[model samples]
Target: MIGLVLAAGAGRRLRPYTDTLPKALVPVNGDLSVLDLTLKNFSEIGLTEVAVVVGYRKEAVYARKDELEATYGLKLTLIDNDKAEEWNNAYSLWCARDVLKRGVILANGDTVHPVSVEKTLLAARGDDRRIILALDTVKQLADEEMKVITADGQGVRQITKLMDPAGATGEYIGVTLIEPEAAEELADALKATFERDPDLYYEDGYQELVNRGFQIDVAPIGDVSWVEIDNHDDLAKGREIACLY
Candidate 1:
């Protein structure tokens, strides 16, 4: 299986720090950037062939691509998303269609987790299906976090940014294992959405798939230490969790 890391976002929320560097390159624990940890996790999971989607500060992200390959002794593929400024992650994924066709483990660049990603990859079953990692209810979740609502104790009913506290069933941890057929369907849905509404975000693509009655298996990751680094506070919290591993 291939590993696809979506790191093309401009990270406007990250502000001044991202103004100088890609959010994926932001230092998390001393020398280790979020990208570093993500690549390391993929390596541990035996996904030696990896592809990174880059946009903002593409040069810096490209510069480290070779370094990661040399350090991990793995092949690294780089795909540029020049329209990152105007599009969302759905567009990024759309740009990596070839890689996705090989069946990919999709991960967000800013997310950090302690779970065994390889185990999760191996746990995936069924054709034309998706396995989404759903985080348990935490003490608090930011408004920007994506929430997943599941039904029948098996499938995802909807995925959306937290708009109401009472509506959220769990947070989406940004780790997903998808079959090639499902990836193609999602890509088609994303393309249609963007064609109709150019400003649509990536979460809208997920909602489109759910609305079409696709079966997305909800994998509950309860108590699994994971954090998404979007700002300085998240960086500190992610480091704290990383220190425990």
Candidate 2:
């Protein structure tokens, strides 16, 4: 399966660090960047062909891309989202439409999770649907995280930006294996949402899919060590979790 890494965001939450470099390139642990850790995790999972969508500090991302390809012998496809300043991550996915057609595994570039993602991908068996790895976060999720609300213990009822701490079912772990056709449908919905309001977040498209009775399976990753690097504090937290592996 093709691996699609969304690294196009400006990472405004990261502040001064992001002011100098893309958030994906921020140093983690001793030397590895978040993007490097993500690619290494993918490599461990046997995903070799990778498409990294980059926009903010695109040159830095490209330079790191070169370094990764040289070091890992990884075949890296770099796609630029020129409109990243105006659009959200759904637009980044739209930029990689060609690869998305073959049922690619999608991930955010800043997440530092264990290398067992290969098992998660192998577990995927449904035909032409979106499979989201939903982690049961009984611990309070941060406000910026994307959350999923479920119904009947199976269906994804809604995907929303975490605003209310009370009603959330779990935090979405930023990994999804989506069938090409379902991705296309999501792309169309994303376009429509952007047409209506270009500033609307990608979660709106997911909510639309859930409202239309689309079956997005929630593959539970309960208590699996995962941390998303969004700030300096998050970087420290991710490094701590990375030690578990």
Candidate 3:
């Protein structure tokens, strides 16, 4: 299976850095970027072929494409998302629909996490042809997180940004294993989500699957370090955890 990374959004809160580069290109360490770490993590899992959905500052990614590929020893496929600056990530992910058929272990370009997170999901994915999300069950709940509601505290009942933090079992940590069997249906759900509203998070696509009686389960990362880079504050935290990775 090929790996995927959605590096499209214009993280406006991160100004000067994002002015010339997409959030994925932002440096967490001295020279290594969030994309660098993401590709590194994928490489550790032996994923030599990967696709990246790029927008916002698409030129920036194109500029670094060769370098990133060389660094991770990966064969990179770039998918363009034209609505990146105007719409949300549901569309960004949908832009990659045609390319993802072998299944994929996807991660958001803006998140900083170790290879262990990928390892966790990969291990749990064993022979199960379902979407498996890497969830942060150990982290405390917050309103800003993309919370997940589970029926058995294991099977995802709902996944949304609007869910009440008190009722959420855990946070969907922006990384997932989408098995091949569910790819077509997921593509359909993502299209429906973006068509209904141009601003829905990609989590809504997973919700659509669950609504259609598909199981979206969670795998706990188990006390691992991870941070989603949204603003400067998150960038700082990302830098801290990046070093540990």
Best by lDDT: 3
Model 1 compared with the native: what TM-score? 0.90
lDDT of 2: 0.75
Top-TM-score structure, candidate number: 3
Task: Single out the weakest 10-residue window by summed lDDT for candidate 1.
Answer: 127-136
- Model 2 residue 228 CA deviation (Å) reads 2.0
Kindly list the per-residue Cα lDDT of model 3 for residues 1-245, writing each as its tens digit: 88999999899999999999999999999899999999999999999899999999999999988998888899999999988999999999989887657889999999999999999988897646478999998889888999988876448998987878988889999999988887899999999999999999889988888888888888889988899999999999999999998
Candidate 2's TM-score reads 0.90
Candidate 2 per-residue C-alpha lDDT over 18-128 given as tens digits, one digit per residue, 9 for 90 to 100: 887787877776677777777777777777789999999888877776789876667899999998888777667777878877777778888887766546655754654
Expressed as tens digits, the lDDT of each residue in 1-245 for candidate 1 is: 78888888877778887897788888777777778887877787787798999998888888787788988767999999988888777788788878878887888888877646445545655644564554555636657778877777457787888467467777877877777777688888888777767777666777888788777776656567778887778878988877765
Q: Rank the candidates by lDDT, best first.
A: 3, 1, 2
What TM-score would candidate 3 get against the native?
0.97
Q: Local error of candidate 1 at 5, Å?
A: 0.5
